[model samples]
Target: MTPQRRVTLADIAAACGLSKATVSMVLRDNPQVHPNTRARVRAELDRQGYVYHRGAASLRRAGAVNAVALVVNDLANPFFAEFAAGVDAALAEAGHVLLLGSTGESVERQHAVLASLVEHDPAALILSPAEHSSAARLRRVLGARLPVLLFNRRLDGDGPGDWDYLALDNRAGARLATEHLLARGHRAIAFFGGHRDSSSCSERREGYRDALAAAGITPDPAWLIECAPTRQEAARQTPALFVRDPAPTAAVCYNDAVALGLMAGLAACGRRAGADFAVVGFDDIAESAFATPALTTIATEPRARGLQAARLVLARLRGELPASPHTTIAPVALQVRASTAAAPDSPLQSSVQARGPAA
Candidate 1:
């Protein structure tokens, strides 16, 4: 027996007693088509099991697909997960679909994913680039035609070539976290989690250093602990804080995941957070509020940042934004909670008390 023929626009037109152009208009949601005519066309198309060929349509239209691509370093991390959800929500509102990819922080994987996404002919791409990604390498993989937005991470170069950037105020956020600890009398504070080479991590570390310097306190080199920005890795590395003489009385962690893990690690080491040891984290993820002795963190508001990134891409696609590439540095706020407090009998607190009631 011969295979059945595929359904086409003409078939639906014939069944609906409407012209093929009318049926086509209905399929494209053209406002000129009458509502009743649209209903008939849609019913017949569904009954015939017709599927719209988006890829083929994009090719026919010279590479205009009704979807945007989002690539992030790690989707499993709550920060990225929330950011992706925000992007998805905004895209859905704009009647566009999202094609997502996770690189697991591998540049090779990012190249592979970008290559695949480009074949789909997305309208634009929003990327949180993997560690060590360079503009030259990404440009080679993405080519010049596609408009791109860089989120959170910056490429290792003078500037990100012709791509719009949305950067979290990493240095400011870290400074805020560190300052909060200092205000609470934590003199020996460690900076924990994330590799030193990462742009975001480095900026945060600089901020940490700035706050310490302002207070005339210099952190020991060993206090700057490096670990993958994940809970498990942070937990595994937490014990290192106590290895040296004059260990940190408090810590400013990379992100919420690391902070939460450190809290667990503290428990395992018979030290309790917010009491015996103070901890402050960056990125106020959802779990931060619910963690035992809620986390004190710098809130980047990942979901809102995601929405802003999506809006930026959408605006660029519509030609609403200027052709000149620009960078938007999102501001962060410190969310104080139980996780951070005055160091137990700290000399800093004693000195402050000695100064006594601001004269």
Candidate 2:
């Protein structure tokens, strides 16, 4: 008996009852090949263990990995989860996939994630950086090396580089929340937040103060609380505000998580968010709408932001447009639910003192 020979292109073509030229075209990914024929050719290639040298290389060069890294400060955060879901939707629509990694709010961990992603050599990366990293360090290291699109958080001094960015106009959004509370006759408004060093947090705080200054209300140095980034921590520290001699009538939270936590803390002290004190949150996460008394919040357009960021990274990868170093969306409408209503009977008048805490 004749010994079996190694499978070749011709062998695949013969086995599939197709011509050598057709097989060759299929291997080359020539678009002229009919879909059925291409599929048949690929099937046969797999069966025969046939490898197309140039075709594989071309696929790699063209980003056939169809991957982009999504690095976030914390994956456990609901806001990030929503943002990641949006990113996944956009990527799926575009025939791509996302590689997710969480930094857990650590610069060293962020560095490690980026480094690990580099090993995969993804087409691009979307990042919400940890607070400790400097723009210069980011630029010096990851900026020049790959196309990075900043999402959610903006680093200080990163104007426009080869990278891209899409961020919320946090300052303007915070102002809207603050002014809304002020309009409801809540003069003593407090700002509760995460890290002060975070650009988004600082910008929100700035907006809060700007609104007060514009309204001729003196900024209270005691009104701002730099609390923890998590919901539990926000709950732990929020009671301090209630204990103050003149508790703020309304509080602007960093995000829905903090807002809900603050509400919990207030409840523990016999105060309710919508019934005893007004509360406004940012990010407008889905749960914010479901929270007891439903939260009033500044909508950040997370899905749109994620889609835009994906587009920016794809465009940069394709060399279609110059990297837009910075991009921001203005605050749109505020979602005023029971949490923000001054009273159940009136839409315009909020029940400041009756603000009920989240259940």
Candidate 3:
């Protein structure tokens, strides 16, 4: 038995007794085609089992497709999940689909994901780069064609390139968290979690240090604890903050995950979080609000940030923006909760007392 011949547009047009051009226009939903003619074309198409070759159509139309690529470091993290959800919501409203890729914080994995996504001819790319990612390396994989919007992490040699960037106000947010702790009379505060090499972590640490210096209190060298920005690692490393002579009374955590982990670790060590040790965290993930004693955090609003990132890409794609690269630093706000309090016998108590009840 031989395979049947595949039905073509010409076959459909012949059956409908209409010109191939007219049938093609109807198939594409072109406004030029009459409603009655479109109905007839559709009837003929259905009768002949005509399958629309979207890939072929996209190729013929110069690679125009309703899809965009979004690559992030860790999707399992609720922060990125919320961000991706926001991106998806915006894209869906704009009649576009999001092609997602998770790099798991590996530069090599990012290369592979981008290579695969490019084959699908995505209209644009939104990338949350892994730590130590370089501009030259990204350029090699992405080529010079597709528009890329960098999210959160910036490339090492980014310079003034023709790419858009959307990032949280990491330094300012961390400063807000640190300052909140200071306001509650915490002087010997530790900067907790996140690797020192990461750009976000580095900025957060700078903010922590800045807040301490502004209070005329130098942070102890041993108090700058470095760990993976993960709950498990933070929990394991929490004990180190209390190893030294002058133990820290508070901690400015890298993110909510670290803060929550530290809280759990404190429990294991027979120390209560809000009462015994004041804690403040950056990126108020959903779990932050429901944690034991609730978390005092800087809310970056990951989901809303994701929506803005998508809109930025859409604007660029529609040529609504200038040719020059754009950068947007989203603002953050502090959410004071039960997780912070004045230190026991704190030196700053005098300053708080002088300011009266408002302080």
Candidate 4:
């Protein structure tokens, strides 16, 4: 049995009375192609049943690619979902498809995913690395040719020195959240969720510490809660914050998931967020607003950051970004909502009031 040959761009161009380059431009959705010509080419394409296999096409055309690889640490988180959507939008706008992967915050899984994607010969890779991902290890898995963008989480130690970096202002965002909690008359504040080793988590924790130090308050070790940066883990670890005699009156959560989870945990413990306790979250994921108390959070605009990441990688591939590893740290802003309020009447709040806000 003879199989039908796949339709080629040349074949489409010949039938449409246009050059292959013009037909290719039309296929790419390039805006410069005249609308009439684009319509003509598209009609011919439909008639011929032309299926654009971009990956296979890349193999045949040297130094040509129209696909990007993206690996995020945890797809379960809504933040990554929104970020991926942004990446998709930017890639589609540039006529590229995204090859997505998740690592579940496991370094071993990340290694496997990157190795598999490399086989596809994608033009670039944008990664929100799992915790403990190291540049030396990544370099071993992914050789130097592939343009890389490290998003959100930084690779451990020295990072990919030559890769593009697009990250949220983690330290600043956490600082803003902590400062807001302080302004609400809460002194015994806890930095909640997330392990302290990951760079993003550490930076946020640092910001929390900075705000506390600035207020002349020495945070108890028990008050700095550590969890898996997930709702389940955050809820499980909630009791750790209260083991001390005077427990923190408020908390700066690692992200929206943790904050929402903490709120739930607080409910289980017979406490209310806006009335009896205060909570501030980071990475204002969509669900933050509708949480029981309408969470107050730091808005990192994950989708916009995703767009910025995709565009940056595309620029690197096109020689638009500087050769010396382009780095972009997007800023964050606080969104105040119902989750936070004046600290509940407690001995800790009174002691703090008596001393006044840390000078």
Candidate 5:
């Protein structure tokens, strides 16, 4: 028979002629163990090639996001994919890994995901909340213990005291889109998609109204559609708006996804996006630039937001800074594309010849 393995914790204990418990205590760096005993155990451990497990060290060091749980509203959206990639890169640099979960825009789903994440005992959590998440529900799952950072979206009517938030300047981005439409001589413009209670949607709506009011135009409430944040829902809603009497000459969409869906819907109605109707979208997603006619959009840096979130988590974990309860990232700028050009000065005119193609 092959010789038994020579070096185990038992072997070390035998060589030192000490009890297994004494050896364990020494190896574990228990202060109760005498210094001489610890020195002897260290010498034996070195001689025997003994290695201690790191699991205890990890648990001791965990603050929030030592192992991070990244919760998002939708995984299908490319915006979330790119943002998660950025979060991964940042987390890797900090020696932490991200665990991602999607809520599918359901409050019950959000609750389930949140509950599952809590059970895993992550060091920290980052959430891009769904529309109907409640503070009471979140607190019940976490029990006021683990640190959580809300990203991209906020809890409705939430005060600053309960949580930390990192998000984009959605209102300003909306203002940019609306202002761009206004600059291009669009008077009858409409806001599209997104639910009522979402802070992001509400801010965007506020900005839309602000721009309209600034330009001496009253918003037509009938044109504002609080549709679901999905392509199919946006597609379903678009034709109804287009078919209405006194249809809007231009529409400002919630995001690139909504804009793309609206275009699809317009196609079904035998309407061309840029040629027949002007549309402006937000988020400046990669596909938005390559879409047919291209998309005129307000740009916010999602990757930058992800990186900032990672830094926030790591900083809190390392105790390098106090937990910031509120953080807001501003929008970058508007990118004008082929979409959302003026239809014509007069409604009866078929087309207005451009002086030159948009650069």
Candidate 6:
């Protein structure tokens, strides 16, 4: 027995009693086609098990790709998850498909993912790059034609490529959180979570240092604690904050996850957040509001940033963006809650007055 031939636009057209172009227009979902005609063609196409190969169709057209590619460092993180959701929502509204990939913060995996995505011929790419992603490496993998929007992290090293940048105001956000703690009379404050080498972490650290400097308080070198940005790592590294004499009364966490984790760690260490210790986190992820004692956080509006990222890449594809490398630094806001408070014995101090010994 011979295999059946694949369905084509001509076959659908003949079956629908319409011209091939009309069937093609219906397949493309072009509004120019009459609704009645489009409905009839769609019905016949579905009945015949027709598959419209988007890649092939895009190839037939001039300067077109069927999908927008989004590569995020870690989808498990709530902030990035929300950001990716916003990207998908905006792309869907614009009638484009989203091709998604994850890197898990591994640069080697990022190279592989980008190389594979390149084969699909995406119109543009939005990447929340993995740790230590380099400009030269990305340029070699992506070639010069692909329009890219770098989210959150900058590429490693100088002479940054011409990719567009959408970044959170890391420094200002950290400063805001630190200042909030300072206003509550906490003198020794720690900047916790994330490796210092990461650009976002470095910027936030600078902000924390800046806030301390402005208050005529220099941050202790020991007070700047480093860990993986994840909750587990932050929790595991909590003991480091108390190793020095006159431990921090407050902490500016890298993000909400780290803050929530530190809160749990504080409890295990017999310290109560919002009481003996104050905590402030960045990236106001949804869980921050509901965490035990509720977290004080900086709101970076991750989902909205994701939407902005999609818009930026789409603009690049449409030739609406400048030829020069452009950066959009999103603003942040401080959200105060139960997790942060004044020093234990200070005037206008936190409601719970018990302090962990030796801190």
lDDT of 5 by residue, 1-359 (tens): 96756466677889999887888788657899889989998998998787654344456554333578898877778888777877888998988878889998888998888888777777788888888788777788777877777887778557664677787788888888888777666788889998867888988899899999999999877879878877788888897676567889889998888898998888889888877888888888889989887888888767777888878877766666665565756556788887776655644234332222332
Instruction: List the global CA lDDT of all models.
Output: 0.88, 0.78, 0.88, 0.86, 0.79, 0.87
Runs in model 2 with CA error above 4 Å? 1-24, 27-65, 140-143, 156-162, 323-326, 341-359
**TM-scores of all predicted structures:** 0.90, 0.84, 0.91, 0.86, 0.82, 0.91
lDDT of candidate model 1 versus the reference? 0.88
Q: Looking at candidate 3, what is the lDDT of residue 227?
A: 91
lDDT of 4 by residue, 151-254 (tens): 98777787357788898999999999898888777899999999899889999999999999999998888888888888988888888888897989899999
Candidate 1 vs candidate 2: the TM-score winner is 1
lDDT of 2 at 41: 84
* Model 1 stretches astray by more than 4 angstroms: 1-5, 16-19, 29-43, 46-49, 62-64, 158-160, 347-359
Across 72-99, the per-residue lDDT of candidate 3 in tens digits comes to: 9888999999999999999999988999
lDDT of 3 at 62: 61
For residue 23, model 5's alpha carbon misses the true position, in angstroms, by: 13
**Location of the lowest summed lDDT over 10 successive residues in candidate 6:** 350-359
Give the per-residue lDDT of model 2 (tens digit) for 1-359: 85877667779889889898899889768999999989988988998777655334536466455678899877678888888888888888888878889989888888888878766767788989898676887665464667787776777666554456677888888998888887666788889967888888998899988999999988677788988767899889987786677767788898888999988888888877787788899988888889887889988867777777777777777778754554645455577776764533345453443243222
lDDT of 2: 0.78
User: Better model by lDDT, 3 or 4?
Assistant: 3
The Cα error of candidate 3 at residue 315, in Å, is 0.6
RMSD of each: 3.9, 5.2, 3.7, 4.7, 5.7, 4.0
User: Residues 1-359, candidate 6, lDDT per residue (tens digit)?
Assistant: 85999888889999989998898888778999998998899999999999887766777894656599999988898999999999998999988889999999999999999999988888889998998988898989999888889999888883655779999999999999998888777899999999888899999999999999999998889998989988888888898999988888899999888998898889889988888799999999988889878888899999999889998888887889888988999999988778876786677663453222112
